[model samples]
Target: MIGLNLRLHWIYVPYLSSGRSIRLQINTVIMNPNLDDVDRKILRELQTDGRASFRDISSRIGVSTPTVSARVQAMTDMGLIKGYSTLLDADMLGQVSVILTINAKPSHLEDVYERLMEDEMVRQIFILSDSRLLCMLSFYNQVKYKMFIETISKIPEILSMDASMILKAPKENQRAALTDEAGLLIRCYYCGHMIHDEGVKIKMDGKYHYLCCPVCSKLYKEKYEKLRKSA
Candidate 1:
């Protein structure tokens, strides 16, 4: 059971896809920095166990110990290494692990954020472009999943929402995807803020919000079009 503490807030950006050249997209991955084969290997290894030592990572990746240390240090310096966390067993805590894709009234965002954070079940919460909020819930079972939907609906700001169960996880651990190329940036819909991106980092409505590099661009698409229409 984790919730928001109001520590995160910023100007929002939306990530969208276009037929433009790939170079532009690469520029958008600034937050993630850059990587090479060695860096990629280091990242892959770190995902399995974040607590792995630098010397161990160096030997495994066939790089000098100092080289591995420098890469790891660079990643942290660049803010790519968000942090290391332990995966928990939600079931043992009287909760079930579930995924939720939310759609809410745009204006009542703070209200929505507050409501979701009130629950101890939401270990993670992310806001998406199309006026949606995504949450991983810690509840008893599917029944609690449904109850979550019902409870959120009580707020008028919550127009509607749907959720699903995570059956299998290719990568059960959490870490930013590293690559030589860049990833899309996203916005936290709650406060209209930018979220760092790394390889399609955000999702909503069973669809990947991979098209845009920033969440605000997606959210403002209609506004941009409306202006063009009036012009």
Candidate 2:
């Protein structure tokens, strides 16, 4: 945990449900902190029940309470484990989920991104190839949704945008596979995205990591080597 410096993405999104809208702030930190079998077990248990006490985790993982506490504290200190929180039902709250795709000028990518981040209704943002953006948005009613569209239209370099409602989501935040499937599948070590045909596979810290692209692969190798040399 000593050399860990993770990327924490903060999102402030609107939860629209039952014609009511509320703000929901979410932070997802992706970190690669040399985790072991015990650490993965602890995380699995925590994901199953975040309210589970250290004593309960210790019993499940077959470790002492103090050991579990120390490991959890280390991960927390490293910013890998932010905090324990409960999930709320957005549909019950009158919130509808939609995915917004936008095409904009390459020069305006950064500016348009910053502008989009200003709206609390924008939950997650992704900049695809060629200045295309994919965003997750939530809105309460037609008035607000139209207002959002009008506001986005005012952006000078934005070309077009398409919004699609998410009717159902079987999995939202489930990251870890139920079994040891990492080896069978190609995944990006940096962003944890599933990699297709194009990727860079490299060995780091005595383990193999496949990055989704050259950029992430280069960054991961440089950071890993720098940390290894310093250590």
Candidate 3:
């Protein structure tokens, strides 16, 4: 059986100002990053076997070697494909995974975020409701974990912190999945023109739509309001 540690703490602190605490929201859109099926297949193959050669990928995906290479390069340039790395076993390294939930002063949200990002032990960070943060950290043992906690406590912005130990991790890092559906052709919101490349996409009224260019995308909101006004 996989062991997991879960902890929760409820604590209240005094508010310093009348202004409400700022809350940060992360973009969790699950779209295909505006790429076609061929690109998606290339990404899926590379993610499955990072060391796979271009020739091997081409053989499996039924594309030319040069085409595969070009697609990979384009994805990298677009920042969709970050640099690859090897996944190591934490048990073999005698390490334990811990999740940390922190409450920071409203004034120090950005500072705390930047500092946590720079910490090598932190694997991931999440912004939560109102100056709150969650971080995943790994350490060799409890002694190291305590030391790291004490170090982080020194940060003036940190108001409170809670920790949960991960006894068993069934799933850790997984890449995005590829779908068989074809990508939608982008069209301008204003002029209804087709976008060949580098078009803008925006979400309005809980739906996402494409605008052929930056200018149209920027002005689309006004167009939406006018349409509403007319109706």
Q: Tell me the TM-score of model 3.
A: 0.64
lDDT of 1 by residue, 47-115 (tens): 878899988888887888988887776566435566787877654566667788878888887689888
Residue 46 lDDT in model 3? 85
The prediction achieving the highest lDDT against the true structure is: 3
lDDT of the candidates, in the order given: 0.61, 0.71, 0.73
What TM-score does candidate 2 reach? 0.60
Better model by TM-score: candidate 1 vs candidate 2: 2
lDDT rank, highest first? 3, 2, 1
Between candidates 1 and 3, which one is better according to lDDT?
3
Model 3 regions more than 4 Å off: 1-33, 175-231
Residues forming the 10-long window of minimal summed lDDT in candidate 3: 1-10
Candidate 3 Cα lDDT to native: 0.73
Q: How well is each residue in 74-141 modelled by candidate 3, as lDDT tens digits?
A: 56643457789999998789899999999999988999999999988998898999889999899988
Name model 2 segments beyond 4 Å from true: 1-33, 175-231
TM-scores vs. true structure, each candidate = 0.54, 0.60, 0.64
